[model samples]
Target chain A: MTTTIEPRSGTAFKLGKGQFLEVVDPQGQQVSDLLAFNAHDTAEVISNGRTFDYADTIYLTTGHVLYSNRSNRLLEIVRDDVGTHDFLLTPCSQDTFRLLYDELEPHQGCFGNLAGVLAPFGITEDEIPCAFNCFMNVPVDGKTGKFSVEAPLSKAGDTIVFKAMMDVIIGLTACSAPKSNNGSFKPIDYIIHDHLDDVA
Target chain B: MTTTIEPRSGTAFKLGKGQFLEVVDPQGQQVSDLLAFNAHDTAEVISNGRTFDYADTIYLTTGHVLYSNRSNRLLEIVRDDVGTHDFLLTPCSQDTFRLLYDELEPHQGCFGNLAGVLAPFGITEDEIPCAFNCFMNVPVDGKTGKFSVEAPLSKAGDTIVFKAMMDVIIGLTACSAPKSNNGSFKPIDYIIHDHLDDVA
Candidate 1:
């Protein structure tokens, strides 16, 4: 199947003050561990008392809103059409690199991209708690009881935009888990746009 | 600079029966959000009487051997390389997959990998708590107080193999964070030796 995606962009704004964030995966493929956290405390940010579950969530092709735990508006996805996305799997870390790959490879240098983005805000790797894998697919089997990567449920070039709810620090990783079906070697691009004053 | 690596081939017994797991970033990198949980209980696991601290912890690396609250051996490094790893992460779950990735991805399907390994023996994910990233280099800068990923001090292909003291089941994920400087697109290979045959 062909993945159809549209380019979208947005900028950081006061999350609850009418800003939002959107992500569009055109191929409808799953992207695991796409998450946002409160940089100061490093706690998993929540909405409606629920942690962001990427697998169970469905980002509309357009016109969906992102909220925070406090019921504050973070961002609104102004555009979409990328197709279905996955959030079942998570981004790999150093420990994973060592456990799954040959022992000869130096895994100590491995780090989580989510932890990378929080560095500037006094959040270190230790402060990084459990995270959200935004786009990726993970299917569970009832009979054999196994998890496997499925095909892309999303298309290419789809977009979702989020307006910042607070002056929160956001960390994003263009995941590269080729070992699983959620991704390929192809690089994905993103666009971040500043919300207009009127929109705020 | 060249990465030094040690390979273990041919006879399995040739590999060291015991190895140390150390965590460090000699270049002075700060890592945060470090966590540890019981692989069996899914409850928060603590070290040195507390959840890991950035400044206080240098190496969650193997050789250090983890102690249970009851003074039992919970986990040991069976394979390793590089001087650093992630201690604060856990294997992704179906619930997490739905919230973090997308809802479409089957939650039950993705859990099989971890469950299949543990379930036959009656182990469950809730029993699989968060883990400490041993030998992972997560540091905090005393002067600037910044945290980031540093090249692991360990040689390439160097590993600390864990010997299962009991019939305990373990779940692992080889993280794929190219930016972390650990492994590549390929999956990490593991050798599940060191079975306490006497205990069984």
Candidate 2:
């Protein structure tokens, strides 16, 4: 098993040998990220090639490759127990924050979590656009043609692993979706491993 | 830009040719569930053929294709604006409902909106396994390896369209995920079209 801790701020590492990161929550739930980014300029780690349109994309556990826009392999889906994740959807915003909470103080209504994390890595807030909704469930309604949150597919310890195939800049944000049924401000645990190493 | 209203059920329909149904909320936000099903088995969709090792896989969006175990294209992602949906994740559940909210009656603790919609369609609740977290932001921490909710990537009026290359039975559930931050709910609206006169 390989365990690597990035304590230095603004430190970006290359996923050399395909590493698996397990994201766990406070309740031991494997909370995943809506979107993950690698700083590979050569397009080594961009997942979701032209298979699905960006605007309508949804993310799930298995059968996908994480590559750069240039189609460079960043991570390969190894274990997808959570089942699915959505890419087209955006995170709740200040407006949604207000809609979800009538008591939210003004100016405190912003989806800054991504920005907060990105800041340390020198990635601008504007650079952090709409990310993938990791573990949240949004099912579709055929009769009315709509979408609604359904029951969660993941358990407290269920996880998904990715084999990192390249050296890329990875950015992840702990979602603070105030509009979810699991809207509580809970935290998730993230672990990074070296290439060809057993994940934590 | 076609519109069809079913007066009897008070449901409306608007479909783009070769496009999947795009649902929206009153706020005009694209209601997240861009659906496609196998023309053969109403209960089966595609699997994540490339990412993980799972047989009966159903893709929400992005990485995986909804191909049948028989290697048939049950549902190919023609378009996805909801971004990458997570398949590893499942819908919210009763425990989560209770965990996210406080003071709500336990009677209200009942979850299973997906089943509510699918059950009527002959799809059992048990079939609703790990689904993708579409358009919902849940980020992972690279350092601490933690997970948290972020704002959604979608805005008001945004929607995704899909084309059913063949006749098929589709299931959807407009999520009524209550805001965990404020206990508020976001309702959704949608439209569907089967063919020229079969629009719903």
Candidate 3:
């Protein structure tokens, strides 16, 4: 199954174990925030700290598994055309705009978008953790420890695929922040394939 | 006023704006997880992402301000006897023990400890975000992006102090994990100074 998420908006859905999820940047310079939770337990949401601790690499790509707050495997990256992604940032929100872009009105950004869609799954605002940003660029300066959102390197049709390790609930957004999407908004594409063969 | 948090335990209390909070590692090699939320609004909690972005350093010390989710200043580090502390990892929990140490019984760790104390202020389990770990050592390999919780660098009587930027609710813990405390558990001390003159 394939679906399109409007720019600056998001949606939530479920995937059975062994299913494949492909998130695509149909247009260049777009960013998407992705979150996951164990279908059996909302408390077992995706954990950036645990995933980073276990993976040991901030730059995750194909074969990397997203770990849960409880340290269980939830999903594995089966393919990644654009490997650069951010695991450090909390999803942007009304506060983000008020802090950075004073000229524009504060939008809820990805955080609110996720909360809006994930509510039906019994997931609340607090259950949302830092997201796995696809096609977003945030480079950190080691000496200064400062990072800035940069334009994504993705081009039209670039995609990243994840294989579910367990039944899971997912919240995803076509990011709303101006800087995150190179100062413009664009829609995102996703597809669920029941088998690896279905992905290709 | 001064208080002591028992080994592997925690407590929470209100802090007035401009007051000083000094967290002491009474014994050497122990870690403390510290969290702050606006006293007026529990939803406006301390944020590591904003702090990291605005402060521009993961290795925070004297003179850095901790920011809130809404981009408000929450606390400022007034004194730091020990310089190195971790800003990346989440509070350790039951699953952390289950995944890392198979022989030891699973303990709720700092996450649970914080949740226990903060609940009274209307902050539920999900409201707890990543904490500001004092005297905890987690060094990330620049090339590999992997980080590990090493024993702290603090010595007996070592302390870190923060000046409240606002009236805030604070949660603190003397970490429970054995590895975090160099194979031992110990108490933590905190003093609330009504004024800078009270600190000395």
Candidate 4:
């Protein structure tokens, strides 16, 4: 099945073991937040710390495995068009917005989107874990270890695919950074397929 | 109300605004993991990063306010006998135990206790946030910027009192580090009281 996640919005879908979920940047310069939870047990959700530790790299690309807090493998990256994905930053939230910009008006962000989309599955706001920012340009300065958000390196139609290591629920949000986007914020598309099917 | 959390176990309770919860190390040398979530909305749980950022210190003590991920005030430390506490480390889990040691038998840990205690309140394991380790001695070396878990500095009868900023649910687990503890792990006590009462 295929779906288009609108800008500043998110969707949740179940990906069975051995299935593939392809996240595509339908338009270049856009970023998406990807979060996953074990379908059978939500406590075992995607953990950035474990993923980074297991992968031994800050940046993720094809052949990397997304690990849960339990150190269990959740997904294995099978394909990647853009190699610069971020696992360091938390999803943008209202609190972060106010902290960074002093803005009061509620802006659409990943935290709210993840909360809204996962509510039906009994997932609440507190359950939202740190997400993997696919196609997001957050570079860490070597000298100061400071991270800066930048425009994505992906081109239009760039995609990354992950094969599920277990039955899992995947959440995706088209990042909503009105001020940070280089020019425009755009939507992204996702496709889930059976591993045995050779769609490529 | 008063409660005792057995060693290697945990319990959950609700604290309303204008109320205080006192966590006591009945027999010193015991550590406990304290985790809180918004009673009305779970998403606004206590966040270690925000609390550290707001306090501008690595150690927590009397008068420090615990902040949630949303930057909302969750708890205020009104009284403390042991000023040392940990906000850097996550609750120990089976995954972490196996990673660090080759131990095959599943030993009791904070993560399991939190999950078990909060299950009745509909909090799944995924919802368990990074905890505030009370009475735990985790010291960081300034020069190398490395943290080492040491024996707790708190003595028997040491206590910390937190005033609820809002209606919140708290989960506490007595540390169950069989081999890591200097000697042995022990149970702790807790008491909830209304701020208007002077029961002391």
Best-performing candidate as measured by DockQ: 3
Model 1 misplaced stretches (Cα beyond 4 Å): A1-17, A24-33, A39-41, A44-49, A52-88, A101-111, A142-145, A181-183, A194-200, B1-200
State the C-alpha lDDT per candidate. 0.37, 0.42, 0.85, 0.78
Enumerate residue pairs that collide in model 3.
none
Candidate 1 residue-wise lDDT, B6-96, digit = tens: 1111011112223221222222221211222344543323332121211123244435445332234544544444545544333334544
Q: Candidate 3, A78: how far from true, in Å? A: 2.6
Model 2 ranges with Cα > 4 A deviation: A1-17, A26-31, A40-59, A99-103, A106-110, A142-145, A195-197, B1-200
Tens digit per residue, CA lDDT, model 4, A121-172:
7877766766888987766543333346678899989988999999999989
> Please, what are the lDDT tens digits per residue for candidate 3 over residues A30-63?
9999999999888888877778756866667898
Interface RMSD of 2: 17.1
**Each model's number of backbone clashes?**
166, 128, 0, 3
What DockQ does predicted model 2 obtain? 0.02
Quote fnat for model 1: 0.04
Q: Write the per-residue lDDT of candidate 1 for residues A1-200, one digit (tens) a residue.
A: 12222111111111233444454453445343344555344343423112221212222223444444322334444554443343222345555445444455533321355555555555555433333334444343322223345554555654445555555555554444444334353333343445533221
CA RMSD, predictions in order: 18.9, 18.9, 2.8, 5.9
TM-score of chain A, every prediction, order shown? 0.59, 0.70, 0.97, 0.94
Q: Residue B102 of candidate 1: its Cα lDDT?
A: 57
What are the per-residue Cα lDDT tens digits for candidate 3 across B4-118?
8999999999999989899999888999999999999888887776676566556788899998876789999989989878777778788777777764678899988998998
Candidate 4, residue A8: lDDT = 80
Candidate 4's residue-wise lDDT over B10-54, tens digit each? 888899987999998888888888999999987678876556535
